[model samples]
Target: MPDAMKILLFLLTICLGSIIMQPSVAQTVVNKPSAATADTVTVRGRVTDAQTKQGLPGVTVLVKGTALGVSTDTNGFYKLVVPSIRAVLTFNSVGYATVERKLDAKATGARVVNVALHPDTKALQEVVVTGGSPSQALMGSVSGVQSQAAHDRKQKRGGVSVQIQGISSMPRAPWYGRSESYATIQENSFHTARKEPLSTFSIDVDAASYSNVRRFLNDGQRPPRDAVRIEEMINYFTYDYPQPAANEPFSVTTELATCPWNPKHQLLQVGLQGKKVETSNLPAANLVFLVDVSGSMSGPDRLPLVQSALRLLVKVLRPQDRVSLVVYAGAAGVVLEPTPGTRRADILDAIDRLQAGGSTAGGEGLRLAYSTARKYFNKEGNNRVILATDGDFNVGEQSDAAMERLITEERESGVFLTVLGVGEGNLQDKKMELLADKGNGNYAYLDNLDEARRVLVRQFGGTLFTIAKDVKLQLEFNPARVQQYRLIGYENRALADEDFNNDRKDAGELGAGHTVTALYEIVPVGAPPVVDPLKYQANPAVAPASATADVMTVKLRYKEPQGSTSRLLERALRGTATPIVQASENLRFAAAVAQFGMLLRQSDYRGSATFETTAKLAEGARGKDAEGYRAEFVRLVKTAEAARRPTEDPESYGVR
Candidate 1:
């Protein structure tokens, strides 16, 4: 064939082939999905209250139809990737009206989509109109809806009837129904020096109350009165008390000053400084992490924070230290066996793999942890179980009494416990305290990551190593000098005068380099007494002793952790009363904390103790705040002050 004819014939064949292949090519192009990244866009914004402009935390942000969703951070910030610009984003919270925002299809780079949610005011009215009490109506509505959904789901599946036992019957729990446990505290009344000359109590070194109080303040709520443990508040910050001398595990110092709240009264300050042992000289640690991976702990501030905190603690462990991990959720199991601290990666991997889902079996976890600790019991080492949980024990043996008995039994095995609480809503503070008190351990609430660092990193030595156990204090006040006196706090720690002499009684343990402070408000002979004079049983004050120039005598008893016998140390308070301005920085700061606690508790004894006064005292006495803990206390005080200001129109927290 000629070259022109061949080329024309080839072009015609190519055109026919192209026409035949066009349908397939078009079909392939149509079936192939576009790149997700090219179509989807990142939406970043914050959620806040419309009226107050305050960020609303724990708000759920989601795509209208997809399962993809995210909860807001503590700062009420969120980031979400959407399938398309036309997609609608929905934001919902417990007490706020639900909102939806449609993304602009034409928008290009990361779009900002901030939203202000209004309070759900109509919810209460709606519930009230349901022809029942507000609470009953609201709960009934929720239950009815959930029941209908379950019924529909059952009908869809061949009309088969099925019931899930032990599952939460309600689809959603009431927002306000979340409850925290706190022990009832009966404030101490004045004890006439003549009748009750000997004031005895166990020394409390736990600082859980301070961080717990800070949590309430941060959440814009006043903490419950029972949650305010004055002694813990005062001892949270490290004081500059002198360490123990030769042959002593701790040193006691005393100061007398005019009470900040009541000028007519005097304050007796007793401070104990535990001897600090070098980290190198400390005993090898055998630690078992009793972590709760329960469903309630499924939040950033709960299990995730616990993992981070444990990681920080792991970084400080030495080769001599050994760590084991035991997790409990519906049941207890050992995630990691006894492993050397050198194998940090293994421990971390175990921790990172932990997921939250199931009821908490805290009692079983404790039993397993104590058993694990005993299996590798370090005779000359720090054998301890660090229980990290939100304190929501819901499974077998969940009662506080049962847990107390279990802890007491395990404590006899010579294994100490460290209860590190995280999260809120269902925090069993009372149970935590009971376990720590009975199990020879200390309780601390880690409200945030910073607190975890503070407890696990900055104060590592004191947090893990106990130098002295069963430490008790007994004070004898001279009736001639102090007509009446009242202990500032330690309502739970207060012991009968005779209990101090009992060696078998369990008291608080003092960790290495830990500081304990106690305050006493004294009413002199001239000061007015809250109690009226007794007509029938008149107790006369003893004559002033001319020989001994002492107002009171303090006696402390403590046992070397391994020893069954306790050693006693006595000191007399004889110094002249110093004005608040002239008092030691430690005394001043502690007094400020006591006053601040009183204010928070709304105690009647908080005479002239305004938040301003507390702030001023704390600011002036924030000495050698190398870790800025005292500074943080000042900030918290300021926050509390702002929260306490009376408002005619209070902000509704949208609890339904």
Candidate 2:
């Protein structure tokens, strides 16, 4: 709390580069997208790995809603048209950066978009947007990745390969989390199409992965890859990314490494830290923790986790921080109001008074909490509403539309929202994501105490202080050097290529020290096209770039707190060699995780990803595999592969 202490903390953090620092500014944000400028041409391309050159299958290619799209073939190449579309495409894959590709569309008829998907050594996950179920997305002019027509055309060249994999994890019946089949159109076990013809392709994660993670969450059994599902990873556990004092290790720092279930596996080490407040810091705080103390949250891993996690948070609060506790059950009411953070005993008492019963009045609780937050309005402090729940808001204004409106309106008052998700069964993950995005806040899942510490106590800066908002990435391909590119993941967040610099567009969030990952698969230029090409755009080069296309630049825009306008920051993509060392711990861990995500999804692009390959990859780059994340990854691979055949075979994942 003192100046000297703060300076000492900064010095220490400088020494430990990974120690997320306390923000320089006192920032409680009502986040928004950065500004946008027109008059730029929208250039698009696909991204694929440099290795296989396949369309890193199941990648996401969106340009915000302007009907512009880019998807790669089995060979990874994308196509799109746009004007002044600054950084048109945001290429994302699990464990890779949510990269923005901006290029000159003309001088290059077909640009070669090649990017090597990095591994996330820090276990960070790239955000995923799951739309209103594919069954409902029937009317848009979508890029066909799974349509029968597209399949037919491809089938004309290849064969259909379909396989439905199931698992038996429960040791009992029902086999609840068993199937990994996502409606693939396969022929004689060879090649085929994804279910949703027009929309994005869905990769069925290996059911065994889900079961493994589930076992960990439900029983702390520590199954392989048992701690995944970004939503759950962020929600189920609470990691304290507490405010770093003047001299304390910024926020709390924790790391772990352990040998996996695999006898040949080495170890997994995990490293974590809190956030740094960069500029214009504030002091007095007003936090409203809106918890769903409903019957639904009474599970072993649900309400209990919330209680324990919140208690930890209470421990980290400074005396200046204020807290409010609101519970939503049969009805919503404030259990505690504007209590000083220093009143630890009293706050814990209030938390203890919570009991699960009655129906959930999520709407009423939300409104009451918002009112209370605004009532004590700490214009100079953090004014936020943290919601903890299993998401079964069956009472009051339970409709999705109503909740969305409530959150959106609350966001207008600069009262940011943070949703802490818990437990399975009736989980409204999609709804939670929408609320967080609309409310200009972030979301996480709390599966256990360690997770709580990791999020709340350990890495608080990235969770709370938002640096660049509405950061949209578009990469223009130099067709002269590349042939095609396909973006990985982020299928639901795709934007119309032209929407790249559109100020009005809403985009993704970036937390302090938080790393986002995405991967692209690309084909080099001069490679013969697998399909016939139409001689369009003759004399493609009409004019030279307007001085902007020297190197692909990452364009970012964000509104200042309480300001109607937005500012911009542009960074040109430079440096030829990928800094394997300076790369954040997020890269390696995330890369491994992405590979795991792909394997679970049973992607066709994953050639030779036998158990041995997965184990070796995880074993090789398992950065700080803390809490055994890498070890767990290896275990899951083995479990999945063994689940395929009986006596511990390495070729299947629940085929038995």
Q: Each model's TM-score?
A: 0.74, 0.56
Q: In candidate 2, which residue ranges exceed 4 Å CA deviation? A: 1-275, 278-284, 527-532, 535-551, 574-589, 624-628, 643-656
Candidate 1 least-lDDT 10 residues: 137-146
Task: Report lDDT (CA) for all predictions.
Answer: 0.78, 0.48
Tens digit per residue, CA lDDT, model 2, 65-122:
2223444432334554443334455554332334555565344344455554433222
Name the lDDT value of residue 591 in candidate 2.
Answer: 38
C-alpha lDDT of residue 257 in model 1:
91
CA lDDT, candidate 1, residue 311: 71
Q: Which stretches of candidate 1 lie over 4 Å from their true place?
A: 1-177, 539-548, 644-651
